[model samples]
Target: MTADERMAAARASGPPAPGERPSIAPAGRLGSLLVSSGQTAVGADGRLIAEGRVGAEIDLAEARRCAWQCTLNVLDAVRADVGGLERIASTVRLTVYVAGVPEFTDQHLVADAATECLLRVLGPEVGRHARAAIGVAALPTGSPVEVEAVFELA
Candidate 1:
C-alpha cells in the first residue's frame, strides 16, 4: 500500500480519537533537522499498548509490540508535522526507552521493533539510522516502551 493508504488505514483503525490533537509538538525544525518529541505506546483508545516493566509485569514480545506501537505514533506525528512522509529525507536517529527490570538485558530486542517498523514504512535507505536502546525503571503512563526520533527533510 502507498504511504497515504497506510496512514488512512491507521486512522480508520482508531488514532488521535475524534478531534483529539497531539499532546506534544510532534516535530520541530532545527535548521534542516526535524526533531520529534518522545512518543509512548498509547493506543488509539488512549491507553498504553503494553504496560508495566519488562521481565516482571510484561514480557519481551509484548514489549516489542509496545515499541512498534510507539513507532507508529512517531510516524503519525511526523506525518502531521511535515504534511507527508515523503518529505522525510533520512532517519537520523532513534532512541528507544524500554521500561524493564534492571536485570532485563534484551532492551535492544525491544528497540528492534521500532527499527523494523521504520524500515517497513520508509524503506531501508531512509530508515537506516543511529539508534540507542535504553532500559529504564518506569515510563510515562506505565507504558512499557517509548520511542523518539530525529529526521532530516528531503
Candidate 2:
C-alpha cells in the first residue's frame, strides 16, 4: 500500500477509544528540529490497544502491535505540528520504552515494529534513525510500549 494508505489504515479514522489518555501536547520545534512527546498504543478511543507488562501480560506479537501503534501516533503528532509529513527532512532519532517483567529481554524486537512502520511511511531516506529500545519496570497507564522521536525539518 502507499504511504497515505498505510497511514489511513493505521489510524482507522475517528475518535479514540474511551479510556484514560494522557494530555498530549504537539511536538515542539527547536531550530530546524522537531521533538515529539511520548506516544503509546492507545487506539482511536483513547485506550491502550493492550495494557500490562510485555513478557508477563502480553506476547511479543501483541507488544509489536503496541509499538506500531505508538509509531503512528508519533508520526501523526509530527504531521499535526509541522503542517505536513513532507516537512520532515529526516528522522534523527527514535527512543522506544518497553514495559515488561524483569526477565524480559526482547525489547529490541518490540522496537523493530516501530522502525518498520516508520520506514514504510517515510521511506528509508527520511526514516532511518539513531534509536534506543529500553526495557522498563513500568510505564504510565500500564501501556506495553511508548515511543518518542526527533526529526529534522525541511
Candidate 3:
C-alpha cells in the first residue's frame, strides 16, 4: 500500500477526538517549521486506547502499540495543519512519554515502535528524526503513551 493508504489503514478507527482545545493548533506554522500538539493513546471516539502505567498495568507490547497509535494521531494533526502530507519535508523530532513504574527502563524500546510506524507510512527520508523517550509517573487522560512531533515544511 502507498503511504497514504497505510496511514489510513493504521488509523482505521479514525483520527483522534477533537477537544475543546484542538490538538492541531491554529497557529501551527513558524517559518519553515510546523508543530503538532502532543497526542495520547486516545481512540478516534475519544476513549483512551491504553490506560494505566506501562510496567504496572500494561506490558511492553501494549505500550508499543499505544505509542504507534499516538504517532498516527500526530500525523493526522500534521495533515490537518498542512492540508497535505506532501507539505512535510521531514520529521524534525519526536517526544514520546510513557507512563511506567520507576524501575521501567525500556521507554526507548517502546518509542522504537512509534518510529517504525512513521517510517512505514512516510518512508525513511521523512520519518528519520531525533527522538526522546521519557518515563513519567502519569500522563493526561491516563494514556500509557503520548507522542508529539515537529516537522519541517516543504
How large is the C-alpha RMSD of every model relative to the true structure?
A: 11.3, 12.1, 12.2
Give the lDDT of residue 75 in candidate 1: 94
Which scores better on TM-score, 1 or 3? 1
lDDT of 1 by residue, 1-154 (tens): 9999999999888776667775557778998799988999999998887779999999999999999999999999999998999999999999999999999999999999999999999999999999999999998889899899999998
Q: Which window of 10 residues has the lowest lDDT sum in candidate 3? A: 19-28
Q: Highest lDDT: give the candidate number.
A: 2
Full-model lDDT for every candidate:
0.93, 0.94, 0.89
Model 1 clash pairs?
A: none
What lDDT does candidate 2 reach at residue 7? 87
Point out where model 2 deviates above 4 Å.
Answer: 1-24
Query: How well does candidate 1 match the true structure in TM-score terms?
Result: 0.84
Error of 2 at 122 (Å): 0.2
* Runs with alpha carbons beyond 4 Å of true place in candidate 3: 1-27
For candidate 2, the per-residue lDDT at 67 reads: 98
Q: By lDDT, is 2 or 3 better?
A: 2
Q: Which portions of model 1 show Cα errors greater than 4 Å?
A: 1-23
- Candidate order by decreasing lDDT: 2, 1, 3
